[model samples]
Target: MRRIAFLLLLAVGASALALSPQEGWDLVAAVESGNQEAYARLVEAYQAGDPEAGAALGVLYLNGVAYPRDLERARRYFEWAQAKGSGWGSWGLAILYANGIGVAQDDQKGFRYARESMERGYPGGKALYAMFLIGGGAGLKQDINEGVKLIQEAAATGDPVALNVAARYLASSDLPGLSRDPKKAREYWERAAARGYFLARGFLAYDFFFGIGGPPDQKRALELARPLVGFEPAATAVWATALYFGQGGLVQNRPEACRLAKDQAKLQAGVATIYGLCILEGVAPGERALGLAYLALAAAWKHPPAQSLLSDWQKRLTPEEVNRAKELLKNLP
Candidate 1:
């Protein structure tokens, strides 16, 4: 959704003739300052005939940013703009259809609109179309080579999302035609992070923590991960791990770290293992039994470290204690 909004902003900037030069500047300021009333007034003033204004207003309605959430109204505005040959409107409608926001979910129709938008030179649509081609979804044929080329082209436009995607492809060692180029991946991630892509920030934080493509910099890892704790689950786990070990600037706080690990365990298997370890080590008071139980749970999930630890633990426990742990595992959520 953030990517969609970014693309819409780009489209609006490109079509600035929708309003007078002064009004366009005011609209940009209003958007930057999040002045909803000013934005609404400008959108109302130009929406009748300006395709750009119609597309922007549609996005505002779709997201309900200071306006009531009205999918039907958004669809109407998108359709109006698309009829006026607005590529952004085509992309917007494609998104709605793809996600079933206001219309029935129809991947085929969504792909058609996306293709149309891309053909009309919408960079966002090109990126989406590339993804569709790569994933072979929406009845599109899989063409990894072509998809890579398209994404590279889109990245050349300095689209942050495209840069992120390109970085992932370039960094993946498992992809058949791509080589793992950590240096290039770091460059792409840095560029995207500078453009405010939080996802890229999380990737860079992981790299910094693990010293991938560079020397370990725990301080930089903490700096990048701190603000993303609540917003990015993977970063939260990284931050918690760093806090637990005091590797970064954070002071050691095993209890808080254990709590954070436990909270994130369901979303990340590694975090589950970390939580189990915290419990097994008695890092927090009164958690030994539950920690063993969590270790059992992680072993059940096929985490190798947890499996090894549980195996050793079982050797030290009596049959009755083993039965109790099994019972606890059965009752675990």
Candidate 2:
């Protein structure tokens, strides 16, 4: 009787195993290959018990890439996947908590789930865990050496974002016990640039334009900057500098330099924006000059050469007049 009962149980389990790859799992495979119809089909065919499908749908809902943005639904799906022990589920949940997206921001919780996913060998979790460690500082007690090591591991696994960040840290003056090696920095930046990292291109252009630790090569700088055109604000400033100084074989063109500076003023947090905000905050017009504007601001504050300019301007006026001018620009209206 016991043998007969065990045989019957085995038969039922075999029948269930026969349909292991469900229709929803197939839909996930299709979605991964960029099949729009298949993705939609998968979303429609997803069953409550399908963890992979749940994780995919959760990501789509979370990002609002195509489907309606639904945080609650995303959370539900992520939770379901978590219940099913999905690595991606844990990783997504960590991101939501870390970014304060549909949840209270909690780095400790984020780190916990991220570490869980990382331990399971999720490459993105590794990168993200490293970023949280690097960026949180005192909140997370940033350990640059440990962060660099983890980032390098992620970058080696072909995380493009990780590649750029690791390269920057390797080149950064802020990393303790890490001596400056421009060539090493350039090497990592080049690796990232090859994978279409626009920011890496911008930094690489700087090295070429300035001949920093490498032979001056303006042509190479221009080449690096060319593909990154229309995207980088700081790159625009660098390009403007090169144009203004005729450095890296660039022809000096004041008009183009002015145009770039004007364009930069429109950008968020650019040097031009700094001047504009300073003016809007009550600094007078022409009180600040463009094109190396800081030099002029320094001069205005009576900083050495700036002091000489202030004295010259004062010679045309009196101390009372200078005090009156200071009073006029004293506070933001």
TM-score of each: 0.55, 0.46
- Taken over the whole model, the C-alpha lDDT of each candidate is 0.70, 0.58
Tens digits of lDDT, candidate 2, 1-333: 999999999776544432222233344435544688976555543452555567667765753434556778888887887677765567778777875668898878888878776776655567667777767632677766787678768778654445666666666455653346777777776765554344666777766765654776778877777544434554564576566557667897655655564544444222243333233223424433221233334444323333344445555555665555456443312
Q: Whole-model lDDT for model 1 versus the true structure?
A: 0.70
Any runs in candidate 2 off by more than 4 Å, and if so which? 1-125, 137-141, 174-177, 247-251, 262-285, 289-333
Residue ranges of candidate 1 with Cα displaced over 4 Å: 1-125, 137-140, 263-273, 279-333
Clashing pairs in 2: 299-306
Model 1: weakest 10-residue lDDT segment is 20-29
Give the CA lDDT, 0 to 100, for residue 249 in model 1.
73
Best by lDDT: 1
Q: After superposition, how far is residue 239 of candidate 1 from its true place, in Å?
A: 1.1
* Model 1: per-residue Cα lDDT at residue 158: 72
